[model samples]
Target: MSTLSHDERASLADALSRVLARQYGFASGRRQNLAIAPEQLPPIWSTLSELGLHAVMVSPDFGGFGGGADEIQLVQRQFGRSLLVAPWFQVAICAHAVARAGSPTQQGALLPPLSDGRAVMVLADRDAVELDAEPKVTQAHDTARGWRLEGRKTAVLHAGLATHYLVPAVTPNGGTGLFVVDSSAVGIGCHLSRLVDGSWSGDLRFESVDAQPLEGLSLQHHGEVYRSTEALAIAGVTADALGACEAALEMTVQHLRTRKQFGQSLGDYQALRHRVAEMYIELEQVKSACDLAAEAVEGVDSVQPTRGTAQALLVMSQSATWILQQAIQLHGGMGMTDEVAVGHCYRRMLVLNARWGDTREALARLRGDGMTKEMPGVAGS
Candidate 1:
């Protein structure tokens, strides 16, 4: 699908903002803690579905709105502003993957429910890790009954609320395969955990669990998909950081304008002005990086979109940390207080920076790209 014009995107953004204001109130620390309130999800899901946001990622052939990466990013940015905590991202990505890889029957069965928000899905990709080592997935296979799933997945966001999970597992031949597992399937288990942002997470266990192998879907192509997913996630997270930064900056600016120090308004101080100016510069840089990364994934070569995404992720991670720190410092001790929204945004940014892959991981991916020759058909080539 072609990209939406800036004005069209802005109209969607405005509508989303209005809905969020009415439904979620302001972005505050208190609201952050209440992210997954059971009572809030159904309505949120229905609202998004009605807005056609749920169908944005699905292809038109599947009776969806047929949106591409850019449209998805736009919606996610709005979601970030409210710190919206629905299972939409998980469901969208999984739906996209299934549409790309699943059999005709599977697509027909999954797409409609997902497009209408009647069901929720998550990607269970986390794996066990040895001390000081990279995480790896355990095998999940059973020759009997043509079923196999033997592994533990960690940090599965929204797992508790999801009806289905798309798990990436290693086949006996060492190839990766995606499997659709119903949450209610016997032998499947979950341990609920809390994220730094107060979102719901779980340690999922599949002990000889039955899974319908997603035929034709190969793990070999996942590198690009993984990178794209990370890029998309970083884009949304950067939006969250931007929202938090805006809130913090606004609060700080108001205080400076009204609060007097040494018989003068804090805004009149040269030092305070410089700090605010620095924050604005950093925010703009971060915003540009995010937009570029989003565009790169949508239009650039599929062989290595991660290169651009990694760059964006690094900038976003650093900018978020810097903005949060500056905002907190400017707010004094009250910034750390539970009553302050800055503290919550600060915490959320920290969590988002570490999710999918942290800054260190992103840097490694970026540097690793330098060792390889450019592939044919890439934008730069």
Candidate 2:
């Protein structure tokens, strides 16, 4: 029996298929890993919004279609297949974090713009210890106007382009909590860099930057909500990896059928055929893991706060790397060159592997629960 209803699956399929149809010029970019700049994402993202693709993570009360296990994993896989350059991946992480932890007022403030794809937010909680979930290194002090934060975050995904940042900090009373800071705050400073996949990340400094407390993010809910956000992030990355693996496999199969070797099509090689079959099996398993993680998040179980996001990511890291490697090796020398989209798929998967959390980091989540869990947004202090 399936956890998702027919309508949920069908709706996502229809929307994503339409998105694939409307998205042209995606494959021909050749050497261009990022097809559009961050600023240029609005028009394309707006089109996705029209298709109701961006509204999947938020509830209908928050100006979204609904939140379930169905759409996000499916859509993210498709995004991976096309090697999408938009900040949709990061944006989805921030959006769902808010959905899980925000107050009604905060949701009212953030979700509509997010659901329609007009706003962007990034989480800035990683500090000296990258995997810590409860941020204690970033200190928040009550100010005359609001709050002032002082700390630094490294490799904040899409920090340069995001208008707002969800920053977790230690309250003066010693409670750990989350706060919302404007990217344009006076004391904030950001030095940006491009990742291998053409997405932007930043090394950020907050020298007493003015911020508003995300008022409703109470202590009782902090750990679970943080774990939930980490799960959503994992789901997005795993979904991407799955999609890229699928594309790489398909691309490899096509290359095998058309390319000639030793007076025979590469597909005629028994060894290579066996490798492809093994890869297909790995891809199906990876896909199943991603789907299950998504379902777990929607189901909201206690023991699995990250909804198996960490487990899914670990599975993806191994499977995606193996599949992409096979794709590259199967394609011969052409795989090493940017002239082929297959190379792009490999690079994108590598980039995803290193970002947020990788296989080792994911394994830490399985090491233990609570503060010991290896998840994004932890304050390993």
Q: What local distance difference test score does each model get?
A: 0.70, 0.72
Q: Which stretches of candidate 2 lie over 4 Å from their true place?
A: 1-5, 28-43, 128-136, 173-175, 299-301, 305-307, 369-381
What lDDT does model 2 reach?
0.72
Q: Give a tens-digit lDDT track for model 2, residues 237-314.
A: 778888888888989999999999789998998999999999999998888878767766764436674536667777
Model 1 agreement with the true structure over 138-218: per-residue lDDT tens digits: 564649688589878887888888888987776665555677899999998888866766677888888998888655455
- Lowest lDDT block of 10, candidate 1: 371-380
- Error (Å) of candidate 1 at residue 330 is 0.9
Return the number of clashes found in candidate 2. 7
User: In order, what is each prediction's RMSD in angstroms?
Assistant: 4.5, 3.6
